[model samples]
Target: MKNRSNQQKKSDRSTSQGTSNIALMALSAVPLLMVLGNSMLIPEFPKIKSALDINQFQVGLLITLFSTAAGLSIPILGFLSDKYGRKIIIVPSVLVYGLGGIISGLGATLLDDSYLIILIGRVVQGIGAAGTAPIVMAMVGDLYKSNDRSEAMGVIEAANGIGKVISPVLGSAVALISWRALFFSYAILAIPISLGVFFLTQEPTHQGQKEKLSSYLKKILQIFREKGPSLLISLFAGMAVLFILFGVLSHVSDILEKEYNLKGLTKGLIIAIPILFMSSFSYLTGRYLKQKGKFFKIAIITGLTIVGSALFFLPFLKKPYIYVGILTIMGLGSGFVLTSVNTLVTSSTTSEQRAG
Candidate 1:
């Protein structure tokens, strides 16, 4: 990282125009859409169950299927994106995502027990998701000069935060019209964003080969071996941060609706409060990396500690403000963890190695 930092400093001296902020705004939509789509679905789960005549177990699979498919496909897509270019992979992925959404939307509109078709749509969307956010991470690193890199990365992270903050509200608003419209919204988003990436983003300069599938898998293992044990720790830490945030949110929306007797826009607004803090702090962390990067290890440790402590106290809270305050507090730590881990990975590799 020090070496990369020094290199970035040298590169920063050159006034490379690189990717414009406009282009970045376009890329920012990817993550914002991802989180927004998922969080919005959380509120829609029960509604979807009723509309589709599915049981609780099947309703659960709406989220589960999407995640499982995305998780499984990312590694493979990572390799393909490396072999090809980010543009080539991303355009198709976005289109596939739109197709999935359309399928789900049509299924919901046309049939009552269209659960099977909707499930298929989610699976397709998940497969497309495999290429969306992960590839964007690699592209952000490729598109910026080192000095601008942190800020660029920050903006994307900020967009992610913004998504979290607004998703519930947006989702609630959209669902008011028809829950089926929610699926169409995914299609609506994917099309323009895909076109933006295709036309606006430049093909990055890199030295990676289009490896044979056999060799690609072998190289992935080799990367693990070369980086040694600390990589595992980093991976685990990043995993835990996302795991905690998503796991809590998965139940939080329902709990608020059922236990606290909150619903609709009010529920969404409440859910967004703490997440607003998380996004704000994530942007701040990225912008001030020159100072904070010096305390990377400290930031990671301190952030996790704050998260754990806040979450520990959440179970005892009785008021809405208390929940909001605790999550806001947790967001500070989450921002640190997310920004640090995201920067570590994005900055550490070239466009090619990032694919693995």
Candidate 2:
């Protein structure tokens, strides 16, 4: 009888773990898709500018507008998710994102003057993006406990890194067919991911639904007051790392094509090098942090130092191998910093206020 009980318990544990893996995978897709909304378009930017007869500044607005929209909407979406549920908000948001992509593709393909239409579509996609990766981070916090949450956070960051590595190459390849095709690809890819997230993941119970909005706001404010310094610093580190990574990538893409005569898939493959390093380091750092939570401050400091050193040396290194080597080091630093920040931010709060 004891043996039978033990066997059943073991079986249940295995089943539960398997289910958790599936759910994590589904959640990871949200960040990957959200990333694709922007990074995948980087390689296509010059082509887009020329096709639409727009200036560099005008073309740049595509990314700026999307980012601005997503940034503005995130807090509101987080509040809604806290009130209702993560999955409910996520499902419709993904659908909206895909719809936005479709509109952009149609306008670009069928219209003579389509820049305005495309910009509108990008705004819509950005709003959808606001509900994606951030909510997934909060949901993961709600679902897991202790080291498991940290590990899951790492996995999510790694997924975002992987998306970055993939986007450039994928964008260039698709652009070989038609740049408009890239827009439609967003919709094509989002559908399955959205469905997977809806069905595969389960949200843990949240107390925010019963709490008054005013009380919830007060609680969040209190959390900020208590952890304000550390949280702000962590947030800043995350923002700086991402800004550097993306800014470097955009510049590299342009120069690789203009100066090095490396365009299309060749340019993209080169762009992927730094991102690949970043992704690998992110996965490793996440695992390490899970095991050694006490080293959070050290990891953050070390990452920042490495990134700073790399940037300082960048101006003098014009040789291809040397330049790429520096970028690779920077990528490693970014991966470490971002994984630590993400884990810290998500695990700091309780389920009730996590999404908010």
Candidate 3:
């Protein structure tokens, strides 16, 4: 009788631990999908630009559309999720994201210019994405204690790296067949992920009762004012710079051919080299963060590395190898900075605020 009772207790304990691990893993998926959706589009941009006959400026706008929408929507949805619940916001967002993917694919097929339609689809994607990534990070903060939270965030970032690593190759393969297919593929990816999230994940409750919108906004403003306004400003500025870099890199093949006389596969490989390094280093950084919780040091190092790389590029502006080296350093620096910043942000806020 005693042996049987002990065995059952052990089994229950194991089951509880297993459940907790799965929950953490699921939280990681939110960021993973967010990054995957964006990264996949990178390799396909050439095909998209050529098919739509869009200018560089127009191509840049497509990225801007997605990011701007995401930025506007994240805080709003985060606040709503804090008031209502994460699952309520998340499930609908996933569905909208899938719809956006379908619309993007259809727009690519049906529209004469297609750029406008694609832009609309990207905007929808951004809106839907707002609820998932940030909310998931907030949820992790709610679920885990401080020490564990950093590791959880690192795991989430690692998952994102996995998605980013796969996206380029997968997108290239899909684009080779049909550019429209890439968007449809994203829709397919979203459906199963959404279903899983809807059925499996539980919405975390705030520790305290919800605050008024005005109050919440006031608190957010206070946090920015008190904790790290200058740091936050610098981070946002860095993000904008990175976005511009990504936009330019997306058109590297054209630049290489137009300016340097590089041709075909070589141009493709050159562009890809930096991305490969970035993905690899991002994964490594995530792993490092999981083991060590030196957020400020990582952030500072990342910033310095980026500044140094940018300076290095100025000296060898025309050399392809120098560009590649700079990009690799930039990627490593970005990975370190992003992971550190995310950890800091999540830690700074309460669970409710994080959700907000």
Would you estimate the TM-scores of all the predictions? 0.80, 0.81, 0.82
- Using alpha carbons, what is the TM-score of model 1? 0.80
TM-score head-to-head 1 vs 2, winner: 2
Candidate number achieving the greatest lDDT relative to the actual structure: 2
Model 2 over residues 65-169: C-alpha lDDT tens digits?
888899888977888888888888888899889988998999999999999999999999999999999888888888999879988987898788779889989
| lDDT (Cα, tens digit) per residue for candidate 1, span 1-356 | 99999899878754344447667888888877777546777766657766787776787688778888988899898887777777788778888888889999999899867889999999999999888877887788778879989888778877877788888788878888898998999899899999998887776766566588788777667767877465666667776866676556655666776688887788778767767877788778866875655666677788899889988988888677787787678778888887777776555555556664
lDDT of 2 at 6: 100
Candidate 1 residue spans exceeding 4 A from truth:
1-22, 49-60, 140-151, 202-208, 226-229, 286-298, 343-352
Candidate 1: lDDT of 217? 76
Q: Which of the numbered candidates is closest to the native, going by highest TM-score?
A: 3
Which residue pairs in candidate 3 collide? Answer: none
RMSD of 3: 3.7
